[model samples]
Structures are given as C-alpha cells and as structure tokens.
Target: MAMVFADPEMLDRLAKSLDSKAGAIPQLKSRASALDAGDHVSGLPAIASWLGDTAKDLRRRANILRSPSESPFDSLAAFGLPPGVAGDPDAGKKFQTELKAILEAQKNGTPQQRAQAVKDYFATLSPAQQAALAATDPLLVGNLDGVPVNVRYAANRITIQTEYTKEAAYLATLKPTDGAYKRTQERVDTLRSFLNPRIKSYEDPKTGQDMKIEVSRQFLVFDPHFGSTADAKSSPFPDGRIAEVVGDLENADNVAFRVPGITNRLDNFNGFTNGGYQLAADPNGNERPDSAVVSWLGYDTPELGDSVDPAKAFAGGAALNAFRQGISVNLKPNAGLDIFAHSYGTLVTSKALQAGLTNVDNVTFMGSPGLGPNINSVADFKMPNTKFFAMRAPGDWVSYTQGHGKDPADFKDITRLGTDGASGHSQYYDPSTGSLANMRRIFYGGDAKPLTFTHTSLDDEQIGAAEAREMVGFLHSKVPPEIVVKMGGDLDAAVQAHFAGRTGVKDLLLEVHSVLGKYNMLDRVPPDEMFGKINDLAGNVAYKQTYKAVKDKGAPDFVAAAAGKAAELASEKLLGAVTWPVVKLLEVDRIANDAKQFGEIIDRGTAEIGGHVRELGTELGREGAQIYNDTKELSEGLFKDGGKVVLELGDTVIRPWNAGQNAADIWKIGDDAKDKIFAKVPDIAGGLNDVKNTVVDKGGDIARSAAETGGKALDKGIDIGKGVVKFFGG
Candidate 1:
C-alpha cells in the first residue's frame, strides 16, 4: 500500500509534485481506480514506498522522475539499499511487507508489547519466508530480539555478505573527500581483517606455495549501524560492527553475551571476539552443548577523549534487550545464560539491568569503571533472582577509571572473579589467564574460586602505581623462585664474564629490560623497581679497564706511580651518578692540584701497605691495581660532587712512570716490562720483593685473571634479547 503522508500540507505537496510529471505518463493519470489500488507496475507493488524520501523530496523542489517498481532506475542518487535491491524494486518488498505488518500491529503497543508482538510475528513466518527475509533485510531481522536465534544468525550472515558486496563496490568509487569515506574504508578493512585469518592451517611456508591459518571464531553480528536508530532523524553512516558471535547462538545449551568498551567498531570486532570464543573453549573443551559467545558491540562507544557520562550507555543500552531476547528465542529449556561486561560495557549492561533483564541467570562484569549512578546495589538492577558477578584482573589498568559508577565486585553480593597479572583489560578471555578459567566455570552453573592476587583499590592509587604493584605481584607469582634463582646466577655469571672481557654489561641492561617488556612486565612494574632490580641483578661494573698495575722499584713508589698515572686521564663518568677518581685524578691538566689531594690518600694507602711489607712493582700485579684502587676516598675528592660513586671503588687503570731524582731509577707505571730500581733504598729490598710477590699473586688475579666468567656474561647479555623476543614471538 502507498504510504499516506500524515500532514495535509505534505499530501497536497505530493499530489502537485506527482501532477507536475503527469505529462510523461499519459494513461496512468486517467485510471478510474484509486492511486494505491492501481499503482502496481510490472507485477510489483506500488513504488511509493520504494521511491525513497530523498527522491520524493527532490520531486517537490523541481522536475523529478519516478520509475516503475519492477524496473531499475539508472539515474537515482545512491541510497541505503544495495544497487541490486534498489533496481529490482520488488527484491525484498515481500519480506519487508510481511515484517511491516508486525511493525504496524505493534505501532501503538508498549515497549514490552511491541517486543513480544515482533517475536510473535516471527513465530508465524514459514521457513521459506524466514529464509527470504534473512536474504533481504537480514540486518533488521537478524538483530531484532523476537526473531529465532538460528534465523537471526542466518540473517546477520547474509546481511554481512550483502554489505560487504555493496561496500566493496562503494570503495572503488569513493574520493578522498567523500563523506564517511574513512569510515567506509575502515569498515571494509575491518571485514577483511576478520575474514583473512579464518584459514585454519596451511602447508609450511617453506614447503607450500603459501602459508595458511585458521579463522577460529564464528562472527554472528557485523552490522555497521547497530546502535543508530532513525526514528526522528538520520544517523551517521557507516558506523561499525555491533556484534560477533563465535559459535551458533541458536543451538547451544549455554550462551555468553559479551559487551565491549570504548572506541570499538567492526574493525575491532574480531580482535575482541577471541575473548568470547576462548571463554567457551578454554577450561572446558567445546565438548558441552554451549551455543556460542556473543561479542555485543551493540552500542555506540564513546572515544577515550569523550567525557565520561554515566548516561552515555543509553545510546546502545537497549541492546541488553536484544541480548536477553536472543537467548530466549533459541536456547533450550535447560540452557544457561551469562553476560560478560567489560570496560565501558559495564555502563551499558548496568542500564540494561536497571530496565530489568529476563531469562538471565548470571550477569558478570569485568574491568568495569562503575555501574552508573542509578545502580547502587544489585537490587537496583531489579533482576529478581539473577546473580551478578564482577571480575577485575589483578593488573588490569581499566580498573582505575570508575567512570561507570561503583564496581559490582565491591558489593558483597556480586561475585568477583579473580585474575592474575597476565590478564590485563584486554586479556580477560585469554586461555592463559585465571579469569578465563573462572568465566568457563560460571557459564556451566558451577563454582569458580578466584586467585587472591593483590590489587590496590583505585581510591588511594594512581593507575600506574596500581598496575605497577599488580605487576610486581603477578610477575613474582608467574616466575617461580627457582627460575629467579637461576636467572640471578646467570646474571652473576654475566658480570664475571664482562669483567673478563667476554661481553659488555651495558647490553645486559637493555636485554633484561626487553625481557620484562616481552613479559608485559614493563606496564606493571614501577620504573624505579624495575630498574633497581635490573641494576642489582644484571648490572655490574666491568673492572677490566679500571684495574691496572703500576711498575716501580718499591711498594711506596709503585703506589705513587699508579696514583700519578691515574692522574693522567680525564674524568670518566660511569653508570648512575658515579665517577671514579682515576677519571678525576688522571687529568693531565689537573695532575698538579689533583695529586696533592690524591697524594694524601696515596700516603694513607701506601702507609698501610708500607707497614705490611708490600711489594715494589716486580711484576705489575693486582696488588698495584688495589694499592691505588684503595685510595677511593682521595680519588672521590678529585671527582665532582655529583658523581654517584664519589668514593666508590670503581677504580680506573692508568700507568704512571716514577721519574725520581735518579733518571736511571725510573719505572714505567703500567708496564710490567719496567725494571724496578729502588737501589737507593736497598735496605728494604727483601721487603719490596716479598710485597711484590704478594701483589703479583693477589692483584694480578683481580685484573686480567680469567676471561671465562666474562665470556658467560657476554653470551647471556646477547641471549637476553633473543630469549625475550623468542618468548614473545620472533
């Protein structure tokens, strides 16, 4: 039947508009029957409903052409209908007309009545008619709550295929500036992303022509304009995927309805579907009759930058009914129902609950900011016998933002599922997480005990700190003490190797950090704690370059010579705020002033060695390295105050020649080749020899002892990066 314009003014305008084009068709205007009765052309119903408002309004402005319902119009501007559907005007009208009867029947009905009326109408459709409708306006039929679950699934898939065809064609014609072009492109890209991964397995890349992978989950809802309704006005075009179910919703014994959070779209639809599918398959093999997990993107999620309005959920809040009704349609008498709400999805779910959910037994919320103002208690939801469950991963960062309201988990009544550090806001569905285990248990009307993972309430903590602590606890829990011990031993070996000239210690820092990053520990650990542990465990100063022998005739001269050589180099900066005295004492320019300060400390060390019958530099030994190395306090005095190791013993190596009063008696400081000549002080020659021997045994061992340890440190340092990359994926 032709639609009657309700406004008298609109009716008059339409009549004149049709009359203006009267000259083109001679016989139709003179028909004795009413316009609605005789308007059918070429076996099609009247084209008035098919002629969209856009073209109809255009006719009022000027001359416009109308086409027969059965004939394709070549000149009409693009409309929402597919080109095939638009051209073949009778294409989906039969289905549309049948559905319209229900819509008309429920027009003045209450919300509940309207919903029931739609469902009843669907119950009366024949299988052939249902199939036709699924092929025609599948988006409408599939998402409508009253439709049977299997029918909804079929309709949605058809809708997706059709939309994919239309959008693919539209993409080829879009210009850079076309309205919603980016959105259209994104829609296409998202669909491709989902479809591309469905190839389960392929021949090995090296052996086969191409590698293959599998599409693991079934996508149930892929509408781009789900939350958008045009009751009074138009909505944005090319909005994204409203939902995707990983399994068949119509035939399963258990159903999980998942709600997504902010900034999700069709592009992100598949990325998020794994959680739902994984939950179904995780602890329990898909052995049970569980139907499928529904990833409900049924609402418009605000961008992160948008203000956190509790009412923001109202946009797609009605989807909760869709969720409730879907399960009602196809679920068996004994089937179970579970709803999982995540992030901003909690807000939408909360609103749905407030309106009263039916046929739902368990409603679980994870990573919820809040429940919104209206729902203070589970009773506020008014879901009589329905139980509420909330689970926040011990380390999920989303817990810090309470935009929705107070968390459901906090209430004694709402069961909070426990999760470990491995599951962040996005990882709730990963099989590796405890949360997934709990979700699976709850879905089957069973009990799940949550891990007592530590968590900082959002109240006295910043998001970073809360995550950091969770990380510390989570990582500590995941890595067994034995592993840490083994790692610690490896790090110690690395330090030894670095000092022995096998590898650099600097690489150790980067490698360990990379490992933590691979573990996703970087987001959870505090910078200080992370760096501190890395420094303490893996970081060590390689004294290979710092320790050196000073050759001199006697112990006193060897000590002075070592100190003099130390004074010959410029100041060197080490890790943190540390600087060795060799860096300060070795400056050739500052040697004169530097020596006086270093000389006093040298006297103290030499005095200590002098009393102990230390050696002269017979064979430049580690004793000589330690002899001057011991003058840390004096060396520190020479370095600037800001140095971290002002007086720390990160001694540098420099050789000094003692050009005493007798040039013949001079000794080359660092060279073991330098012949010691303390003939002028032969009285202590025996003592000098003894000291030299002691120094040779001790100091030499410290300086260039074994490179074996350094080789290990070096190998470990290099392996750290490789190990972590491999751990995450190389």
Candidate 2:
C-alpha cells in the first residue's frame, strides 16, 4: 500500500541540488543590494538578510540528508524487497529468529562487538521490516545499541506514550488513599512534562519584539520502571532511567553527555534536561544550531546515606560505557563527543574511562569528591587523547573529604578551570557562573584559559588589583563634566597614578580630605570612626569607589570624602590582623595548635557577633535613612543567631587563603569543622580567633572589652558600606 524506493542515490542527488541553490543565495543578495531603488522603495536590505537566513536553513537540511545516519527511505518510503518477502506468512518467525541471534551475540560480546552485531543485523532489514519490528516491540528497538538515532527516538516516543496511557488508565481507578496513587501521580506528571515541547523565548534586541524557538528533544533511552522490585518496596522513591538528547543529534557537529550525581530521579528530569538545553543552544547567536547535549540518568544513584559505597558508581560506569558506545557508533564522522560529569558522576565517569571507554574528545568534572582510589593520574583512564578538566569552587566542601580517592582537580595533568560566581556543591552548572562558561568552551572547542583564576595563586592578587582598577575606571566615568573642567581634568592622572601604585590609598585620602577641608565641606564627611568603620565593612574596592563617585557628583557628602582615608586605615588594621593569623593557621607545622584555637575563637566570635549584627543592622537602617529594607532583613538573617553564617563567611575567606596547602592536617581542619568547634567554619576560624587572642594579649581585660566594642562598630561600618553600595548601584 506504501511506495517503496530501491535507490539511495536519488537522495544524494537531491541534497547536491539543494546545496547548489544555497550557494547561489549570496550572489542573489549582492544583486538585490546593488539595485538603485527609487525613494519609494524600501526594505531591500531586509529582503537580502531574509534570503541569507533561508540559504543557511537550506544548507542545514541538505547536510542532514548527507549524514550517514539519515536515509531518504527513513522519511519518504520503505525499502523495496522482492514480492514474496512482503507477504510471506513465515516473515514474523524469521524476524524473531534473527532478533534472537543478534541478542545472543550482544549478551556475551564486548561493547564494540555488541555494537557491530546490532549494526550488522540492522543492515539486513528493509526499512519496512524495521518499522514493523519497531512497532511490534518499541521498547527493544528504542534501546537497541545499533538502531539509527532517529529511529530509536521514534521508537522511544512510542514506548513513552504507551507507558503514559497505561499509567493514566490505572490511576483513574485509584483513590487518594490507595497505596500506589501518589507514586503513579508523580510518574504521570514526569511523563507529561517530558511529552510537552520545550519552547525558549527571548526578546529580539534589534526588533524589540518577543520571539520563541521550539527546542527539539529526543529520548534515546527511556525506562519508566527501572529499579529492582525489592529496592522499590523497601523505599518510597521513584527510580527511572533516561538519556535525553537536546538539539539535532544526527546532524550536530558536536555532542556532549551530561551525567548527574546524587539524589537524581525521573521526577527531577526537567531540571537536568534544562542543563542540556543550555549546552546545546548556540552560544554565539547563530541561526543554525550545531551542538547536541544529552542528559544521561542511566543508572541507580545512591541516596545521601548510601553514597559512601562505590557499588552504585561501579554499576553506573558499566551502563554509561554502554550508552557512550551506542552514541559513538551513531555520531557523524566529524562530530566530537564530550562528557560533563558532576559530584559522584565524576567517579562514575572515571570508572567508565578506566574500563576502556574511548574516542572521547573532552571530559570535565566539577564538584567531584574523587575519581577513584586507583586513578591517581590521567593515565589511569584509557582515553589517552581526551583533554581532562576539573573544577572545585572556592568554598566547595567536597574537596576536603577525598572520600572516594584523590581529587581529580589535584591530578597532575588535568586542567583546572575557574569557578568564579559558583560556590558550594551544586552550582557548577548554574548559568551565571564562570564554571558553566568554561564547560561551554570545552564543548565548543574554544580556549577558556583567559577566564581561568585559580585559588591561592598570584591570580588572587591579580583579581584584587583588577577590581581596584575597575573601581578607578568607574570613578573616571562618573566624574561630572563641570567638575572635570573646573579641576582641569587632573582626575585621570590621579586615577592612573593610583593604578600604577605610585600614589597609595593614603595619598588619595589626603588629597580628597585637604580639598574638602579647604572648601569647609569637612562637616559633610562622616566622623573619622564612622568613616573608618564603613570602609572596614566594605568587602571590595567597589564600595569605596561608590563613595568617591558620590563625592565627585557633588551629591550629599555622606562620608564620601573619607573613602580613601578610611580604606587605608581599615586595610592596615583589619586586614593585617585578620589575614596574618589565617596565613599562620594554614602552615603545615602550626595547623595543630593555631588551627584548633582558631576554630574555638570563631565559635566564640560568631556567638558574640550574631545577635549584635542583627541589632546593628536595624540601627544602621534608621541612621542611613535610604537603606533598603531587604538589605536590612538580609543583614539580620545573615547571621541568624550565629548558626551557619559564621561557617559560610569563614569558608569564603579561608578557601582562597589556604588553597595551596596540600597537607593532610590542613584538609583535616575542614573535616573537623563538620562536627567540632570549627565545624562549618572553614579556614577563617583560626584567623578570627587569632584576632581575639591578639587583642587579649595586647591589653588584657581592657583590650578584650575594646575588642567587643569594636565588633559592634565593625557591624555598623559594614551596614554603612552596604548602604553606599546600594545608593551608587554598585
């Protein structure tokens, strides 16, 4: 009843014809652009642009036909066979026997051999017969290693829809009180979400209009019921396996697989798939998409309590290797494949790599606990040509554990990526982070070295210096034109001198202070103690620059004239005192004594500062007048009576400070912080404690009392800094 084609050569001819048409579009655009139109004529350029876009789309479609995985028969018609082959009564039996033989070969073969067997068996089937086989057993065809990617996607869609129908029918007969109702409902929701098409919307910057692009998703593997019955019965959890492809897999120039870590399941599939979408989209705003990303949740991941065991990772490795093998065989000849793994997924990826998974172009591991005990170097993996990359955000606690083995980040030959804008265990893939950008670079074969900033290296000092320069640049931009004219534009020389380090903070402070004093605007500057306190509170140069910008603008002084003076003093007293002890605490020999005491000091400081910071936050809110209510609330909740805030702050300061320390005892400080006085307080615990000790040693009871008073003052100063930052829109 259906037309059949005996020749594949016709498809090749059609593709070449389309290519010729596409090649002529630019010349046509040139001819249209050269036409001298009358004043009444318009939009010729727009028409040319449209023609250019059409050409790209035509080439893209033509390339799809040129792909090895796509055949004309796949879309147009079934392959022709002898008349007896179509209607033979024994055809079903013959198909079953062939499938059994292929399955038997796959069961005992190596991954490569299994792929070959599947490919060989499939090569024998006419397109019509293959379609019939897929329709009869969609699950088998959908998950088969050697099936064409498009055919696998179609089969899997059928399987998913069938499962959805069956589950929905079963759910209709159940009440809310039924034991299976909740699980079934969750399953239904996840399936429905997957079935729904993903649409990305954005505003056209040039046109100022909303536009939407429908992102294509293909399910390469989908299993709704994946875990053992006993495991499901023992725990109330959803267990499903999936590998979803985002973008055009068959024709993509590059493909990447994203492997998730702990606590992942079918219910949270959308979140992981969203990561795939981000990676697959063209970063350069191209009309034609060229990358495909796969979110693979193909094995049982451990729960928090069960994560200590490598049993799950080992099992996952086998499944991951098999999936990659399937992809390897199906990918276009010029396409590159990469792997992006996170947390425990890194361990799984390492295991697969060690187990002989090859042909990978790049591999990235983020927030990884460890690769494996035996994988001490890159050579431990079989992927010799693959470029290995690893990243651990400054405050990520996973690096301290080394629970599984050596950290891949510390591996000798691995490239370490920058993690700015990312922190903690789960933010590596966040859209706003440098970590994600670096990962994207690796996927697209771009160099990310320009973005790299390693913790505790000279890079830290460079970052600080760059921030200072940026502040000065901001000041230059904000200086009023009238003020610049009146001052004879000496501000540029002053800024350059500061950037060159020829003029220090104290020099700038004196200049500003003298000028304001001469104008009798001294009254406008906040008191020395308040100005110094605000400067102390500020975290970076931006806050001080905000004050300078406000001063130059001739706005209400609001302590602007004291910015440099206060900054110089704060850096001398607070930074010198706080940073020295931290430096000492990280020393290999002193970690035992100073590190323990430092933890105790932070514990005490947090307890003292927590409630006071909250009160100080409120008091500053009233004094500042223009402070944001949200900022006040943030300050109050920041310490939250000194529970987690102290540890987080300590982590922020200490991670970069001690990043170069490789001693076990230094790492043990983090381990001990999890449960002891230093618990949660990272490297900063010792520094804060040393500050307290320095105060106590210097003046005994009197100095100790002054230290507490200073703490409150510091909190007030910080609030002022926050206000200024907000005011200047820093």
CA lDDT of each prediction against the hidden true structure: 0.52, 0.61
- For each candidate, what TM-score against the reference? 0.46, 0.49
What lDDT does candidate 1 reach at residue 683? Answer: 29
Which residue pairs clash within candidate 2?
A: 598-686, 673-679, 673-680
Clashes of each: 35, 3
**Residue 67 CA displacement from its true place in model 1, Å:** 33
Off by over 4 Å in 1: 1-92, 110-124, 173-186, 193-222, 226-237, 284-287, 382-384, 447-730
- Tell me how far candidate 2 lies from the true structure as C-alpha RMSD in angstroms: 29.1
Top candidate by lDDT: 2
- Per-residue lDDT of candidate 1, residues 26-111 (tens digit): 35534523465554443222333343443456454233111111111211111111233333435566867878888787777655
All-Cα superposition RMSD per candidate: 32.4, 29.1
Q: Count residue pairs with overlapping backbones in model 2.
A: 3
